[model samples]
Target: MESRPKVTPLTRPSARRSHVPPLGVHPTPDGGIDVAVAASHADGVELCLVDVVEPHRDAHDPARYAERRFPLDGPVYGVWHGHVPHVRPGQRYGFRVHGAWDPEAGQRHNPAKLLVDPYARGLVGDLTYGPETLGAVSAPRRPDEPDSPDGRWWVAERYGAPDDRDSLAHVPHSVVVASHPGPPPLSRPRVPWADTVVYEAHVKGLTATHPDVPPELRGTYAGVAHPAMIEHLTSLGVTTLELLPIHAFADEPRLVAHGLTNYWGYQTLGFFAPHAAYATRSARGAGPAAVLDEVRGMVHLLHEAGIEVLLDVVYNHTCEGGDDALHVSWRGLDNAGYYLHDGASPAALADVTGTGNSLDFRRPRVVQLALDSLRYWAEVVGVDGFRFDLAVTLGRTQHGFSPDHPFLVALQTDPVLNNLKLVAEPWDVGPGGWQTGNFPPPTAEWNDRFRDAVRGFWLDAPREGSHGRPMHGLRELTTRLAGSADLFGHSDPPLVRGPVASVNYVTAHDGFTLADLVAYDHKHNEANGEDNRDGSDHNLSWNHGVEGHAPRGAEGGDTATEPWSAVVPLRRRSQRNLLAMLLLSAGTPMLTAGDELGRSQGGNNNAYAQDNEISWIDWDLEDAARDLLDTTRFLLALRREHPALRADSFFLGTPRPGEDEPDLLWFDADGAPMDREAWDMAGRRVVQMLRPGPDDGDAHVLLALNGGLDDVGITLPPAAGGGSWERVWSSSWDRPEAPDDEADDVTLESLSVEVFLNR
Candidate 1:
């Protein structure tokens, strides 16, 4: 990367203290049409009015348009006044500034760059990309050439391009002008954390290729709220649809080069604005209100289904990168104040996001901006909650990451956000990045441990010579299944308790889909165009037989045929076992999109840049996939039916009222108590868990799992309160079978799980 230009307070012009002009169509103090552009660094600013129908060669055609130059007494801080006869909404204009371009000392302010309005609510044309767009300077003569003396001049050319004639003709110039229309009136569903089951999904990928969704509505907000989509989510018993970021984001320059996009939508350009691409109606002709209405409609429909809407928000940084960055909103408004700069140097940015810059949460105004944006989404968009991406960056102050940082404190105390479900990714690529369990009370975090543990148990442990020991034994797995109290038990009030505090998952957007987890061991990222150098190395995954592509039914190999074929039967069983473990756990269980239907990324663990079929959910599934979905549905229903499994209090290894047995009990293959030796034995595979009855006092559950290669005999402990054991559901069994009401013991198949009720 090229070294960023240094910006010093003393060397730069007094324009550093300029203010941002207000946005939107509003009457002036005199009740006349008022238009202004906020250009803080301009010595002399001119608003050029170009004829929409004229060609570039006809610049001298006075018959079509005109230009007005406004000399500034100082840098135009807020608004540069242009009265009725000159400017108004729908007027197309561009800015020309007069400043310095001294590259040696880091002051590159070419008046010819033609800056976009920082407060522009809409964009009329696509940014042209090519060497000619780099201004008057020539392209680097050679590939490895460094920034030449005229590099700044070359950079200026790429700054501005003529708007697309057709795209611009249809788009009104005034549409780009910001308007401070007060918050939209929105009806919100107030659901508590205990009753909420969040379903995390991608806005575009979720319905983009769904056959049931209309072609026009595919990958848009309308698709998300389509009757079919709503009905499906409602049928799944989802209480909250936690959408990945829908904010306007820029495709990374590299990913774009490879014909891929930032499908995950993590790179945000505007916090308060929605991504125009996700809108069914064009933002250009229909305007921001149209987009807002569609988004609100989606929220309304979800609310009508009694499901809440939550947004995964990225506030760690702005899309405008380093010194070579665009003068977009925050970077233009106040780069030094809005972004975290090296405290010692005070000129270079401290990039914690690895996206070129990190927002400075220490700055009060920046903190206010984040808080204001959160409020805007929650109030204006009618969102029920927010999942902060790389949230550790938001809570960091000058001293380091603080639990009581002003931004966090403000969120915790703010009346509007107080009751909202606040979740955090919890860490960033900064010093002390692994702060998984360090968040303050009431903030649920993505439990990476749970993901690893479950993956280890069902996939990694089954494959021999996989380096790590198999997690087939009960103790460690049981702790994760019970919410990992060891990691979250330190809070004074114990905020991260029960089902509301932990977002348990086996897969997420950043990793392989559940199917791929059981199909591949190493990341195959050659498609990322980095010579397979990109993506993480620590997959902790295993392919049962063959490695990547293998012949069908090839004996002794881990290929999809032999060992991989065996995986087919084991995959569904393991999936159900994992799903049962997640739903029955004491934390909030999050289901990754398409995990229910067995979506596979073709063993490509990292599909960040694969936006094609490899990343899109097939939706079409085989019989096994259907079976997995049905099993998940049944497990979800079981969780809904039992409050004891989802209790608000942490299990203390003690019995409940009217039950002589502890709330949870561990048993070995022979139905005997699991002693220390048995718990430590690496050969142990059969384990059983018993949960006490709920408030009804008539329900109790016995969950048994046999990971061995053959059937294992299990003796049932004496029934609590003189009741007999009855099997309610089993992964190995096709239908729900009543347990042997008279028997004290039963045998379970290899790699199977069974859930029983006491009568």
Candidate 2:
């Protein structure tokens, strides 16, 4: 009954405000840090501060730092925030979000476990995963469940309780930084998507072994921006450097347990933070600020060299994993809102991604988080664009995948984002997940159909017989070579996506390299420790006259004890043919990194987990490798010179009224017109594509294909000017000392591709 001060309840409700303003660590005039984070279902939120740990240690040592917590005020629009006094750009911090612990309902919030700030722009160190730090508890496989590929997934349940596990010593804390994070070298290159050649390279792998890169700078951001690397990219005629994910990511705990690492950097932890591991050791010694400068400086130098930087972003999933996984950020802050959950049990995640969890696109705040992250990278970090990994998951709804999803629409219309180049992987492993060529205008999607079709013609032949499928037809190959109009342009309103929508490539980062495509017919993934069953078996590759590397054969082609050289001719010619098919096609072409230099992974198709020599590019180029490099540069230059080769629109097949000749003319092996009957031939293996000269250019291009086992005569179609055809380039270039055999019949050898210029 005496005067006792009223005690405040722990739960505080946040309301949607009229003018909510921005979130995350914004700098204030008084030199304090304004911290904000979005957590709708949280009962409370606190910004925790820790003493800056210098010379960062990896162990879970408690005596490393001091800790203090400050409760945030009213969460405007479900965003809890507060301005911390005496805080500057270098202050170290983390979040302790206090909420419910009901995993069954998909709300696994525990303040005892420290969480990462979702909007953290700079990360300090690597995530130290353990039983308590990772939170992924396991049990014996259940009898009722079927076996999984990894066996550990079939009966696994990510559900776990918030143990009173204090992860302060093990968990990495986010760093406070200046409100304006970067001054990217220049504005977005805004390269025309049609003219763009995406060179997909890993930050570390691209420069890790380059000889000219300073020993200390090798594998660092500086290495990628070094003059040596820049010269190679520029000489290759690549307009954009599409780097593999450099976002702050972690090696999957299971990958670590298997004695491997995530070399691809797909297991992202923080969307706004660059992977600090890729920075030079000197930069790490300096501080996080130096790391930021190094990354920004790389981008700046790239822009100066007339190149754009696009990030391969993995926003579909995070390193937080699922119910049994770690509570690094979103899972601990507001699990139910951040992820899609099973409607019936709620606790079980609706993981469309192979990863344990998929980001929920239905929630507005969740969409905002992704948008904010994209803006941070595009505007603050100065990246030209993004290639969204598992992009179908980003457009999914409760009803299934929707091209008209809110997130997709927002991406197309956002003032700042619409101008940026956006590419989608276009598929996931879930139901109705293959949405290739379905995404709307301006956003290009990876044309896997094109990839398979090219591979089908060049590598997978009917009689090759190494687990390869039969070739569809010469017409099928033409359809892909002409930008796969049947797939991307066959829409109700005519062509939904033009020729530019298809990113044509025979090889990508996910599958075999140009060299390995012809070197090994089967995958050898024993180093992954998964029993060689981790990668796809549909390689469509041929061993060309030997497996792995055999002894040289006698003059007639029989090997006794020496390594065989019989397969070498077909191998080199095949590499040139594949390269020609990619660049000469009428679509945006993407060249995988090191493919020009004939890079190989020792027949390993899936090297995602190999962080060593297996994944790093071998800079020491062999003779064949140098030839392939020169051939690649020649093809790229040809593509740039011939406007007819890079058509802006799909060919109508029939002649246009005003044109002197048809936009594109198709022919069979005997020079006859490709009628319906000829195109329908299942065994057909020869084709001739005649592209007339553009209005301004004089070069009329002819692309001929001979997939037959023996040489057959090819007749040139009559040209508009009635001029003879001249052989400009051939896939079967000088193999050692063998000149292309010229003949009156104009016969071509088996599996050969040739290009001609009609005067």
In candidate 1, what residue range of length 10 has the lowest lDDT sum? 163-172
* Per-residue accuracy of model 1 over 576-671 as CA lDDT, tens digit each: 667777777777888888888878777666676666787777777655567677777777877777765665656777766675567677788788
Which lDDT values do the candidates have, in the order given? 0.65, 0.79
Model 2, 163-190: lDDT tens per residue? Answer: 6657777777788877665564456567
Error of 2 at 294 (Å): 1.6
Q: What lDDT, from 0 to 1, does candidate 1 have? A: 0.65
TM-score per candidate, chains pooled: 0.82, 0.92
State the displacement of the C-alpha of residue 164, model 2, in Å, after optimal TM-score superposition: 0.6
| Model 2: lDDT of residue 698 | 67
Q: Give residue 728's lDDT in candidate 1 (0 to 100).
A: 70
